[model samples]
Target: MESDLRIAGTNSRPDIVAWAASEDGKVVPWVVIEIKSGASSSKPEFVLPQVAQYASTLGTADNYVVMGTKWFKADRSFRRLEPVSGPTPPPFGSHGEVDDPAVVEPLLTNWLASLTREMAPRELPVGLPTLEGFSVTNEAYWRAAMRAIADTTSRSGFAQHSSSPLIAALVARLIGNRLEGLVLDPFSGVGSFLWAVADRVRGAMERGESPPNVRLLGVELEERTAAIARAIGEIAGVPTDIVAGDAFRVELPMSSAIVTAPPVGMRLPQPYELLNGRVTTDMDLAAVDLSLRHLEEGGRAVILLPRSFVYRSSGDAYREYLANEFRVGALIGTPRGAVPGTSFAGVVLVIDKGDAPGETFVGQAADDDWQVQLGVEGALTKAAVDHLDGFSEIWS
Candidate 1:
C-alpha cells in the first residue's frame, strides 16, 4: 500500500493505493480506497465520479469509497456499487506489496486509485475541492489537466460544440504575444479559447516579454462547463473570470480581444437575430456582430466561422459591411476537421475595431503547423500582408 500515489499520464493522486499479486503471479493494484470526512462524508454521489475516474485512470475495476466502515464497494466493472457487508481493515493490510517492474506493468493495465473528480454541482460553484487540492505547478501540468477535463467533457457529450485544441491554439496565435486587459470568449465552451489564450500569454510571460497582465474572461451556457472553466482558469494561473449564462444575454465587458467558436446551428433569439439578408439567421454572422459590438475601439477579435459563412452569396451585405466598416485583417481557412464533433472545414476571421477598410489578409493553413503559417514572417505571412492573400477567395 502506498499513500498519495500519483497516477501516470495525469496529475490526479489517490490516497491508499494498494497493490498485490494476482493468481498467475502478476502484480496488480488490487484495491483503491478513498476516504471522506466532514459534512460531505455522507454523500456518495459526491465521491462516486471521483472514484470511478481514478479507477478508470489506473485501469482498475475494484474501488472502496469509505466514509466510515466499508461504506461502498464497487463491482469488477465499477459500473455499480453497493454497501459493504461489514467494517474491516482496508485492502492494504491483506495485500502484499508488488515491486517487480515486469509484473507491475501488466497489473497497471487494469487498476484503480483514489479519485478527486467530484460530481458536477447542481448550483454554480465558485470553487471545487478537487481543483483546489490539485497542485498544478507548471504550464505543462495545467495543459494536461485541462486536456483531461476536455476528454471527460467530450466523453460525457458535454462539450461537443467546443473548438479543437489546434483551432484554439491557432486563434490564440492571432491574439499574439501582446495580450492585455480583458479577453472574452462568448461561447466559452469548456473555456477552450480562454485556455488557449492563457497558454499563449503564459508562454510570453515566461519569456519576460509581452502580455503584461491579461484577464481571461468567458461566458459559458452550461453550469457544469462554466464551473469547470472557472477551475481551469484558476489552475491556469491567469487572472480569469468565467460566468455561467447565455453569451448573448449576459452583460459582457468591452474586451481588448475576443476569441470564440460560437454555436453553429442555434437559432438567434429576438432582436439579436441577424439574418444578413439570408433566409435564416447566420449564427457566425450574429457572433461576429455581437463580438464587434462588444469590442473596444481598436480591439481585435478572432472568430471561427464555417465555410458557408464566408462563401454564401446571401451574406454579401454582411461581408461588405465587414470589409467597409471594420478592419478585416484576415480570413484564414483551416484544415478539415477544424470543428469538433464534425467534419466541417472552417476559417479564422481576424478583425479589429480599428477605423480602417482595406483588403483582408487570407490564406489556407496546411494540415499541421498552422501557427507558423499564420504567425511567423514567411512566404505565407508575406503574401497575406500584401493584397495577394487568396486561399479562401480562390476556394470559395
Candidate 2:
C-alpha cells in the first residue's frame, strides 16, 4: 500500500483506492494521508480543515492522518488520545493535536502489538514479551541490541553483512501463519538474517501458535560474521547454529524452508580454490550450488540473486545448474533501487527441491518507496509465492 501510494502519487488525494493487501490477509482502507514535517508547533487548525474537506469529497470518515513530530494537543473540535496517560485536556479554547514523537511512537507500537496479539496466541519457548512495555520506551535499546549483533559480526572478522527490519517482519508473518517451521540462510551475512529470523520466531509464539523450534542454521565464511550471528540469536532468544565456514562446504541441518539473501557480487573478494594445483573461476556457481544442496526434497527456498544471473549471456552455467536441481517456482522481477546502497535490481528466485508438475511466473509491481520496497514489499512477495506454491505440500 505504501508502495502504491508512493508510485500512484495519490497519498494526498481524496479517492479511496481499493487494492489487495500485502500486510495481513485483509483489505485496508486507502484514504488520504498527509505527511507533515513539524507537528510540535502547529495546531490542527489549518490542517484539519483541509483534511476535512478532502474526507467530505470522498464521502468517507476514514482516517485522515498526519505523521510528523508532535504530541497530542487536544482541542474541543477533535478527539485525541495519548499513549499511557489520560486524555489530555483541550488546549485553552480549541487546540487539539498529538505532540511528541516519543509519546506517539510507543502508542502506535503498542497498538500494533495489540493487533498482533489479538490475531494470534501468546506462547513461546522462552515466553518473552514482544517489544511492548520497556522496549517501547527505549527504542534505542532495541536498535542497540540489533547493532550489538552487527558489531559482534563486524569485529569478529566477517566483512559482509546487512541489517534489515523488513526481513524481520517477513519472518514474523511466516512464523505467525505457521507456513514455515524453519529458516536456513546459507548466505547469512553478518547474521542479520539470523536476527530477523529469530525475531519472527519470537513473534510466532506471541501470536498463539506454539512457536516452532525454528532453528536458524547459517554458514558464514567470515568468522566475525558467524560470531555476530551467534550473539544476535542469544540476545533475541532464538536458537542459531551459525558456523564459520564456506556456505558451499558447510553442512546444514534438515529443515522445511530456506530464506537466503546471497551477495550480489557487486564488490567482494573473489573466492579461490586449488583445483589441480591451480585456482580457477569466479565462484558464483559454487554459491548457487550450495543453496540447492541445503533444500530438502520437497522444501521451498527463496534465494536472492543478481538479475543478470537469470538472462546474462555468461550465466548459462548457473541457469542450467538451477534447472537441473530445483523446480522453478517463480521469478519475481525486482525494480531498480530495490536494495539500498546497491545499484543493481534484485531477483527473488523461488525454488522447490525436486521436480513439480507445473510452475507459475508472477510479475509484481516493484515497490518504489525505498523503505517499503526493502522492508514490506520484498518480504510480502516471497510470502505470497510461498502461499501460492503450497507450504503444506512442501513441508508435508
Q: Please tell me which predicted candidate would have the highest TM-score against the true structure.
A: 1
The per-model lDDT (C-alpha) reads 0.65, 0.48
TM-score of each predicted structure versus truth = 0.62, 0.53
RMSD of each: 12.7, 12.8
| Candidate 1 Cα deviation (angstroms), residue 113 | 16
Superposed by TM-score, candidate 2 places the C-alpha of residue 329 at a distance from the truth, in angstroms, of 1.5
Stretches > 4 Å off in candidate 1: 1-141, 149-156, 271-280, 366-396
Report the CA-based lDDT of candidate 2 relative to the real structure. 0.48
- Worst lDDT run of 10 residues, candidate 1, spans 107-116
- Kindly report which residue stretches of model 2 are placed more than 4 angstroms away from their true locations once superposed: 1-159, 167-182, 266-283, 317-321, 355-357, 370-383, 390-396
lDDT string, candidate 1, 1-396, tens digits: 554456677777776665554554434556678888888876765777778778876665468888765578866655666798733343434333333332232222111010112443355344433212122234434645555544443332544636666567667766542256899998897788788787776766677755557788889897776766676677677888889998778898899989998887666665454424343355677888889888888788888888778888867788887887888888888777656666677888888787477767778888686556654344454455344223322100
lDDT, residue 153, candidate 1: 37
